[model samples]
Target: MFIREITHWFARRSFQNRIFLLILFTSTIVMLAITWYLTDITKERLHYQVGQRALIQAMQISAMPELVEAVEAHDLPRIKALIDPMRSFSDATYITVGNEKGQRLYHVNPNEIGKYMEGGDSDDALYNAKSYVSVRKGSLGSSLRGKSPIQDSTGKVIGIVSVGYTLEQLESWLNLQISSLLFPMALLLLVLLYCARRFSLHIKKQMLNMEPQQLSQLLIQQSVLFESVFEGLIAIDSQHRITAINQTARRLLNLSQPESELIGYAIHHIVLPEAFFYDAPQKNKKDEIVTFNQMKVIASRMAVIIDNQPQGWVISFRNKDDINTLSLQLSQVRQYADNLRAVQHEHRNLISTIAGLLFLKRYDNALALIQQQSESHQKVLDFISHNFRDHHLAGLLIGKYYRAKELGLELIFDPSSFVEHLPSSLSHNEWISIVGNLLDNAYNTTLLNREGSRQIECLINSEGNEVIIEVADQGCGIDENIRQHIFERGVTTHNNGDHGIGLWLVHSYVKQANGDIIVDNNNPFGTIFTLYIPFTREE
Candidate 1:
């Protein structure tokens, strides 16, 4: 089964699965974003904490009376001893005592025994802190500093005592805070994850318990909405095995026993000519009526494609008759479409001509020609188009010829002298109407006769005082049960989308000409329709 099958099988679900999915999506994103935010915030807080502790430690070291006296009296060894006990980080190489003027009072290293530390410069970190507070990256990006003013026995401030350390202390402090924070965040994440899994399982169960018929109904409803769809719908497994075939699929694929156990049969095995999957969305494919096994069918497939894998498909079918009628009607409508397109093309040319005339300042000639030749002429053309004799046979074949070609069915009509000369013996419009309807019906039947090869034969021969027009096809002939009723207004053997108008119209129009029409299944495998009209006897 595929994702679509899972969805379709449980279409009437309570949306539990979707809700769990939403929760999982939102929770994960929130967790990651918040973790990043808190981590950065904690790192900054830990950095500041390290700085504050260094200040306190420096104050304590500087408060030593011996160290303070050492700074004032410029005692180097005393200052080094006082700083040594306080120093911990090895990166803090040496310690120095500097005065209020940033002049070095004492240095643990002999090279700085009497060096004057520049007040604003960083030659001495602790001395600079007395006047200005800062953390600066040194020769090796590290600095922790503080300044403490020293006093003499008279309690007068004279020099500043300072100490310096490297940044390892700050790293230790940050890591401690980070390690402490991890435990709680991990707990929160685990709890949410546990909740998500539980919710997902519950939702999945609810979705699994849902019904599929509801989804099927919705699909049928959608079918009732669109027009001119050509694909034969085949709902099948990825192996092309049939599951549920629709009416269109039945006709297209010879799914005669619709209720039979067609569930596991390969679709290619069912229909003579196979239909293939199209890239259009499972729901958005063009619905065309195609012939299979010489039967007319509207076939389309709803393949369950997930992760680019085909699992199954939903095959839907409607009768070929509906499609045939629709195709015919669509062709009929095209008559007006061409005329409209022609008018637009003519209008464009007229506009261009008018623009050119105006540019040449032939204003009077342009206006008069526009009114008399363009606008007035357009109205006359429109009237002629409205009353134009559109193809008399346009409605007859319903363009079923193209469909016949697709099914490899042979459909031929005798384009004899009578086709063009029928007007001489019959009413021109009536001839168009009758010949077109009969031929169209022939083409349809020939395409659908799945039992054997199909062909059409037409012979318009004059016998005695009247002319004869016969339209015939070698097809799976009409059933004996429906033969008598074939000429009735609503008694059609096959019902898909047709209003059962073809034979009925043929009967009516032939009767109006005092002509007789008959259908005979003389062949072992197909049907033949013969039409006879009285010759217009010249008085």
Candidate 2:
């Protein structure tokens, strides 16, 4: 019952204890597995090395001239002194010699000393023997044997040099290796178990001290609550000094950080392009402090509505880029709607002309006119069906296509280079921005150019798994003064209503697709915009 109670207490501990336990189990399992494998490899290597040493010792001792002479002389003392050190072998224990009568001259121990070495082909055999080279041992053991003999000057075998050792040495060495391997691993297991327990305890303490609800609340407040429930803020005071700031106010004025050399500096001095600040609001109503273009924005100020006016003038003026984007999107929608109205108007006019021709008794001519209209209309409808139908980015591309046409510029989609089942990583928005912005820029440049040909070419080709797109135009190639700044946001050569937004959008889309874009004036070939898009998202 006491053990059960302790188990229940452990189960009731915080979630982090469970995580730490999991880490401990997995890490220890992996570490011990690797340790065991390394131990086995070490043991095998040790046994191999010891076995080789025993074999070489046997060969070297047998090859000695004195040991050979002792065998030939049948001298027991000399033979015993030569090889008496290695007598513990359970399987192979034999030293042999061969004389001219095929009788043993001598051996190490008296049990086998002076025994005949038998069952070999010729008496000259032992003279030709080599070290660690095995031959059939016919005297005592069936094991492999090494033989080296003493020889006279006439190449006659004086006697045999014989030594025998079994694989029992390899077995004994393996046992010793196992002992050496197991001891260190057993000690490591003890230390590692203690480490796992201590690690779990430390992790449990840190988890017990944590409060997740409070941390989540902090992130929530930073993202959501801080924007609304605070000060009525204005970045500049009545005299245009950098008097007050909030999160939104600081963002509005583009304040620098770290060593803010421009702090307490005039707001107008730091804002981009000196022209924007002249029309900035002064002292106005509490709600209508700063006018970003025509949109009224309440500036950030101190928290109060006192003296029938703000206690202090705080304003939130925004950059003009937002205003321009909002306006352009609105214009695109409105202008596209207008173009549809015009298409409907043309259809009505065509119907009316055919009806009036029939009434004026020009039936044949009316029929011919109807056939011509049908062919032309069918061609356009077929083009739309073939090029855009079922395409993932069709709706997106069509919007920009119509917008380009509405601007008195042509968007020429190449007839021969249409693709189907496009790469899945290229999102709908990305395709739209890539195709739309490039086409829009080319159209704008073509309109601006006074050249003979006014054309904007949009080509898309899929090669293997990659997509290559090029947008070009016969516009007077980008002027040198602004060529370096063409793709940068808010930098423009001519800014009427098209406020330098397209090329930056193009740059962003290419980067998002894991791609690159090269902008080059085509010398005598116009402006060529190339985009290389990869087929996959590695991350």
Candidate 3:
């Protein structure tokens, strides 16, 4: 339990602190171990070297004939004179001359000259007449000692000569060796710690100083959010490779492979319309509307920047169904508002007329005029409500009636125009555009004529999933030169600063509905436009 606690405590430390501690601990252990090992080895080697010199010194003293004769005569003073000078000159810690009976004859300490010698190497040198070297403890502490036997001319042993050096001398030399190594080892430890600190700092910067567990949690959250979004999103790297693609993006792109394998592949290989991603990232990002997989979608792009440098890009898109639905709602609201404004203007004019008649004291005439106007407006409303059961179509025709009357022009629905049912395939907006633009164009052209003839006629009929519409205006007929391309974009007879997209939009809608449109410019009075739109509803 205690060991585990220590490990846990160390793991919780900051990266730099942990690294420093580890490096220092390891380096200290290694250098100390090496120093201890080398110190012991040097001590043993020095002891052996000093022992060799001691043996040589003992041999030189034993070779003197004067020392052998003096030992044979039991002359202590002569022996001491012979050995004392050798001890001082050879730097030996102790020198002793002893007889073969194990009794000391001469010593550095003169009081022990007659003492009995005690030690295994001393016995081997004196009695057995052999020379040897060994380590032993004496009165002056531990020492490396070398011993040799002195003999007469017949090779008989007389006495022994022993030379010794204390272990304290070896210890002093070992201290000097350690002193030389300490500085270099300290420098090496400092270098190791510095390198470890630098390495830890680099890793911290790369990871933004966040814990590993925190980074893992953040990645999991981002992944969940990416897949949960309804809109499609994709990320591209600087090399134009697809780095990431969400589920919605894969589905929109019509990809069959797994997202993992799709990464690192060039985006151009996946998206068929390669022009969509040709432009690099710019400061001002814009939303682009494009067609993908036969579906209309709005795409938006943004650059991923770091330190004011471009790294990659992220693109997101949403399908156009939502935008179109909102646009339809807004157009309906605007149409209703226009209808109300026209009605308001007409009512104001009527109120003024009635006020003028009353102010002139013509009460009977004002009442009659109000009744007549009421009856006329009711008749027009009743006719529209009765003929068209579809509220949208009826509302549009009624609104146009007021608009036409306001312009001093007469607008009428043909008696033969009958639609018992409206199909679902033709949307309300499409119907409004087709009928509304045609009527508007007719009204504008008829109003241009000052020949005292300003009139328009509208016919609407449906038969077996097909809708037929015909609008005619008593204005100057279309010119033959521009009639061929009249339904094309940027083609208009008005010659005003307009985009001339009304007829083009009409033609485009008819084509999208698989319908047809024809122009009858051969009319003696004005021009006529007829449209046929077909739709199918499954049973």
Q: Which candidate leads in lDDT?
A: 3
What lDDT is reached at residue 292 by model 1? 63
Q: Estimate each model's TM-score.
A: 0.32, 0.37, 0.48
Model 2 lDDT per residue over 158-186, tens place: 66555555445545655666667677666
Give lDDT for model 3: 0.81
Clashes of each: 31, 12, 0
lDDT of 3 by residue, 449-515 (tens): 6763777989998855688999999877788998998987678878586747778768866876778
In TM-score terms, candidate 3 sits at 0.48
Residue 288 alpha-carbon offset, candidate 2, angstroms: 29
Best by TM-score: 3
Candidate 2 residue runs with Cα over 4 Å from true position: 1-342, 345-366, 387-392, 396-410, 422-426, 522-525, 537-539
What lDDT score goes with residue 26 in model 1? 84
Q: What is the C-alpha RMSD of each candidate to the true structure, in Å?
A: 26.1, 28.3, 13.4
Estimate, for each residue in 278-307, the C-alpha lDDT of model 1 and write its tens digit.
334344332333446766554555567666
1 versus 3: better TM-score goes to: 3
Q: Candidate 1's error at 106, in angstroms?
A: 5.2
Which residue pairs come into collision in candidate 3? none
